[model samples]
Target: MAVLTSWVWLLAGCLSAAVAEDSNVSALYPPLWEESPEQISDYRLEDGKHIMDPWVITDRMGMYRILLKQTAPYFASYAPENEQNILWGLPLQFGWQYTTGRLADPTGMTDCGYEAGDTLCVSVDSWWADVNYYLSVLPFLAAVDSGILGIPSDQISILPPLKDQMMFCYTVSGCQSAFPEAMGRWSAFFQYMQSPSSDFDGLLEYLWAAHTSSLEYPTRAFVDRYAYYSDQEANFEKNWAIAVDYIAATRLPTTLSRVHSFQNGLPPRVLVDTDIAPYIADFTPLQNKVLVLLNVLGNIHHFTGSLFLTAWESAMSTKAARKLFLISFEKFLETSS
Candidate 1:
């Protein structure tokens, strides 16, 4: 009986030790299962619907926050001063040092919020670093496309016009080049809607035209290279249809008519004070639909970037080319917003 009692005490002590160890681990790497009140307050999620900013919203969602925290220890383990260097800044600087045979200080490279000691700022800085790096690579990509990578002019013909298409797709002012027919149709529809004699039948016709142009047969020619990802392609079509339906079902014409009326004679201050809020409220659903469509389009952009990277990798077969492709892909993911 005494021996049994000893065994029981030993087991309990072991369990206590294990629990204490787990508590330490939890302190070292906190899980983000529940957001703290401070985080909620800082991010302004008290109302549940209003987001203070993109970063705050992303933080509230715990998007990459826990991952950054959990990985902090590993990052700190290798830094010279045990600095919080979360973005592999130490290693990157060391790599540059080794390559150039000179000690490189990455302090300036760290952005406003990140200074190698703040874990959260490190993660955010790393993200923006990648964004800036990718943006900076666009000119290099353009140069490569113009024959810097040594691809014969003849071989260039086989490559898709990825850069051109990307620019056309992203540039709001250049939309006419990408979808001339749709732009022309929408222009005529808007002109008619703005006229004094505009009626319900004309609105219905405009809706039909928008549906046909935007949904039934979109500007596929611009994105023809992406036929490989059939699933994404299908989603693109479906999301676009939803967007068109949302627009058609909304009080878009009425809102536009009000705008035209305001433009014609209404006092600007009166229009701003009275009409703007209702116009925005009326288009809120359409705005939500646009946000959804933007997400879908972002996915499409990622896939297209992957396709372009693959093509570039295949054609150039060089380390520089691979790096360029990676940069281009990162740019696509960042800018697709």
Candidate 2:
């Protein structure tokens, strides 16, 4: 079965908080002003940047094949003139680092809430790390292919014809596809599966007019090239570096100053790839206690909001103070081993 990692923010395209629209933070750290609080259309962050525009895609099979365009940034554009070798915009600093020097990884860091195991390094920051997660939705796949890709509960074989029709130059004119034909061909494969009776055709007609696939950095190459400075690997280094130093010096969990981060770790580390067994033990007891308490409260129905908040806070404690995640990792089976 295809995995559909649906997120609350996917549908929360509108923003309710005025704070998001007016926040001076656009200078950039985290996007506290998420679309959830407001309609993304009202505050299209990528408006003229063209590169970040949300509507620049080509539909293939049941997927949106995104291509670069002249209006988009030179780095991500597929246009021959704007074609960047890397997927996303590569920063100049990492380019210099790759050519001019090699920075040594911290050989040792043993601290609660942080661990750099073997050659692989790991870091722990507060919710600041959540940005590492991507924003891919099945809806994206479905819209590109007339909602056929939205079927996550069943096994569907790859349709060869759809793939064949997908490869080509991307433009509003040529990029527009005959998703109706594709949808009709797929309808017979599943009884429960329903294709729109030309309603989706009209929707596709509308959707096909504007391309919408520039919201994310699509490839590892893009991340590697553009994120060299703050790549997850490097951020892991930074967070772990701070964590280790803080723990080693304080011999305890403490709120770390952000300034101490990432000096040695150029690219942030990727914990998603970490072996859970090696580091799961580092999760602190405080987090476990909170999660356990939340579980106790979850038995009741009314104080539910508190239960959710407790769970959320407990999960967010990836800082130097929680081993509650040992259970979390085991529950999620995120352990590398």
Pick out the ten consecutive residues of candidate 2 with the lowest summed lDDT.
Answer: 10-19
lDDT of 2 by residue, 60-152 (tens): 100211311111232222223322212111112112122222221222233212223221111111122111111112222232344232322
Clashes in each model (backbone N, CA, C under 3 Å)?
0, 32
Q: What are the Cα lDDT values of the candidates?
A: 0.30, 0.23
lDDT of 1 by residue, 1-337 (tens): 3532332232122111111112222233222324522222233333243222212222322322322333334334333322232222212221222232111112344332332433223222221222222111221122223332333322211111213334322222243465555545545544554456765445445534643453322333323322322343334333433333322332122221122221121111101122232243433433333334334434543666545324322443444543343344334334433
Choose the strongest candidate by TM-score: 1
Best-performing candidate as measured by lDDT: 1
Local lDDT at 234 for model 1: 32
The worst-scoring run of ten residues by lDDT in candidate 1 lies at 12-21
Model 2: lDDT equals 0.23
Predicted structure 2, TM vs. truth: 0.19
